[model samples]
Target: MAVRTQVKFYYDVLSPYAWFGFEALCRYQKPWDLDLQLRPINLGKIKKESGNISPGPCADVFKGSLFFPDVQRTSEMMELPYKPLKDFEESVFIKGSLPTQKTLAACQILYPDNMEELTRQSWLGLYSHDMDMTDKGNILQFAEAAQIPDVDKLLEFSVGNEAKQQLISNTTEALESKCFGAPWFMVTNPKTGRREKFFGQDRVEMLGWVLGKEYVGHHPSQ
Candidate 1:
């Protein structure tokens, strides 16, 4: 039996870059044995701990101005579907930790297999369709759209103390691991006992290199 390389992906829905990274990972064709472990995290808490405030509000006056355009360019370059939310800065705010917490709750019940679809739909719902996932009603609607079973039960569990704690634990674990942002990846080669950390959707090629896979830049033919 071949040993599988493990890739741990830490993400939050607040970051468009994380959404891009998630899409890439989902479409990635494994050239070698691999296992992905997806962990939902709260980027706001990570930013608070790292003293990094979001630049979205003041992006026009700062280097942050380049952020969104760059993301757009990257998405185009990679041929990934992307549609920026209307009134992006004003519309896309995390009301609370409820969104991330709900992700963790869903993971607890449907993880190790169902998370990718859940996350993909969630991202598309928020960014592309302008769905307000922060609201419970919207979340249930999203669950229904994604075909997640037991919507009522999941929503109840999501707001429970255990789900909150799980989100906290994941956030703490991410911070302790020196993660300061979303779309963080930790790749481990069990056979060689080697591990590497990568941040950003841009690091996908580097990750491929680490995994001993050829980095084929995006092509129109693909």
Candidate 2:
């Protein structure tokens, strides 16, 4: 019997990069025979602890200006939707830990088969439609949109000690694993017992390579 490979995806909804990365993984998981795992992380806490600022707000004005354009280019390359939330820096920053907690709660309640859809809906709601995920009402709204059968149960679960601790533990584990950003991947091939870490959606090809899949380099026209 062949041992299946496992790919653990660490993400935060606050990042557009994470949204792209999540979609990329979903596209490749079936083809690669990967046991995909989604783990919620708090990128804000990770950045604060690591003394790193997001590129969009970095002191280098030129670098800061390039961040959104780079995101647009990557989104186009991946053939995924990209949209900037109005007042993102000001409004979304006030959302605190709610988004992460909500994701953690959803993961606990939803089956693994449905996780990807839930992730997509949440990401689109926040990044594309500018839904305020930090708001409890918006959380339930998005949950229902994602086809979660019990939105109220999900909301109730999100506020429990178990859900909070799970998010905290996942975030702590991510930091311990040297994850400094969202969309980080920890790939483990059980057959060969190989483990590697990958960052960014652009590295999906490299991840495929690690899984023994042929690397098809990006073609802009594709």
Say which candidate scores most in lDDT: 2
- Candidate 2 lDDT over residue span 1-96, tens digit each: 866688889888778888888887777766677788888877888888877667664446887788878888887877676687677666456665
- Candidate 1 lDDT trough over 10 residues, lowest sum: 92-101
TM-score of each: 0.88, 0.89
Model 1, span 1-222: residue lDDT tens: 778778888888777888878767655636544587778887778888978666564444575678778878987876767777666655555354356456555565554365666777777777777766677777766667666666677777787777777777778888888997888988887767888888888787787777777666654126
**Which pairs of residues collide in model 1?**
none
The 10-residue segment with the lowest total lDDT in model 2:
213-222
How far off is residue 215 in model 2, in Å? 3.7
Candidate 1 TM-score, true structure as reference: 0.88
- Candidate 1 differs from the real structure by a C-alpha RMSD in angstroms, to one decimal, of 2.4
- Clash count per candidate: 0, 0
